[model samples]
Target: MLDAPSSSPRLALVSEDPLARGALARALSDQAEAWTVVAAGTQEELEAARGEPPDVVLWDTGLRLEEGAAPDLGAPVLALVADEAAGELALGAGARGLLFRDVAPGMLGAALHAVARGLTVFEPGLSHVRAAPRSTAPSGAPGPDTLTPREREVLGLLAEGLSNKAIADRLAISEHTAKFHVNAVLAKLGVQRRTEAVVRAARMGLVTL
Candidate 1:
């Protein structure tokens, strides 16, 4: 992968479907002046590659949103979803921007740049799918103070889509210990899965996707 210059915002293109990922990469190929596709792969592959995180992650959520599906790539995410429900789920999962899968190449480029600049972008038609209100925590959710400092660190790692072994390496702890901390974070966040915990934390303002 080519390293993007500071003047060129780096982008990571992620999609579970290889064909979709290839098509998007091709679409981005001509936009080198605006941004660079520094990485392209499934989330797991990207995580395993361990490259520098991109400025924005363009994730294609095909056809529908899967249960507990979320992209936590340690950068702002611009999700390409199929419909309103998928768009809403993307926002709830901490995606900073959303667009329909059939977005024009030009519009897609604009959305990527907007998201990289810390602006939320959404297809005008899907404007109704907004982030959850920050004023109120999810019902029955614990306060932010519930997580210990170490657990908070683990939570941050989880948001980055790190595996337990990767988290252990980063924190200099045993994999078993990392797993323990991960479980603790999920429990404290009142979530049964890592994706759910990340979504809950983002909604709660505990972590900025």
Candidate 2:
């Protein structure tokens, strides 16, 4: 289960551009007295925030998710992107919603509240991108895409920077089993490397970042 939010939700903001980061922080101050904003202008701060997990992570174009990481944060994150493609990347990283820089300040609070509830929030007139094509194939089709839920769970953990031993401990499995699942994920994606598997899976929308 996800962690419960404190009396007031904690907010974390990450932006490569300090001006943009500060602007967002100031705009969010009107949200709630319980809300606290933690500012991060680099990947280092982003990682640090993830360790303690903020209630919300407002991401601008500056942040990128590295390999061996699936977004498994305790707090929800809303991504700010410059365009549609950037939004897709944020979605792959488990962002709860995508917004452009021009969004009205009033919407930020509502968006944050919506995302905290696990729904995707966006501007009313923005276009929605479809990720997958409809398929008529049976449930057990003959291909690597038919991974079981357990396999998907393992794959997600692998993408989240967990070593084999670490994943084993988290899942209560043997290291060998965790390693086996990682290999399976690689083979399913038809990639020989962990990095490639993550990229391929995320692009295909088979696995979230």
Candidate 3:
């Protein structure tokens, strides 16, 4: 569940670029009233967030997702990405929101508000780049390329960042059924993780955000 927006909502900005970090801080500060914007250039600084975690963490996509990493702050993460592919990867890696670095003031403010409400946001008109064709059997059967209509529906919801419970509720199916469908989708996509499945489905044009 999302936290309620208090009188003063804290926002955390994480970026390595000095100019970009400073500019983003100022922009967010002016984005809304009583917004406590905190800027951090390093992971250590972000880890040391005072009181409860910030309402949201806006990070630059240039910072690679380190292996075995966990969420540093207990807030929804909004990533600054360069393009569609990067945005998809950020989503796959569990960033709740995506915005281009050259975003306008209105869009930045809107993205922050949307992400704070526990909604996933991606840059408009972003689509996946075509991936290499998957190897098929000698008989030319569709190997992992064919998903049932129901599985396709589940895939789309997964791309939207819905949990099993939410997907079940949205699809009018039991939670166990939702889990089964999700596992089936992952297996058919030849991926081990939910994010990888979403990325592969996007590459295949099976779903869009």
- Top-lDDT candidate index: 1
Q: What Cα-based lDDT does every candidate model obtain?
A: 0.80, 0.64, 0.69
TM-score of each: 0.61, 0.53, 0.52
lDDT of 1 by residue, 57-165 (tens): 9999888564333456678999999998888777766788999999988888888888877888879988878654222224675888877778889899999999999
Q: Show where candidate 2 strays beyond 4 Å.
A: 1-6, 30-34, 48-50, 62-73, 131-209
- What C-alpha lDDT does candidate 3 achieve relative to the native structure? 0.69
Winner on TM-score between 1 and 2 is 1
Q: Give each prediction's root-mean-square deviation over alpha carbons.
A: 11.2, 11.4, 14.6
Which runs of model 1 end up more than 4 angstroms from their true locations? 1-6, 32-34, 131-209
Question: Looking at candidate 3, what is the lDDT of residue 192?
Answer: 94
By lDDT: ranked, best first: 1, 3, 2
Model 2, global lDDT: 0.64
Compute the lDDT for candidate 1: 0.80
Q: Number of the top candidate by TM-score?
A: 1
* Candidate 2 least-lDDT 10 residues: 130-139
lDDT of 2 by residue, 120-205 (tens): 78665434842222222244322445565556777777678778799879987655457666766766656798778767767777
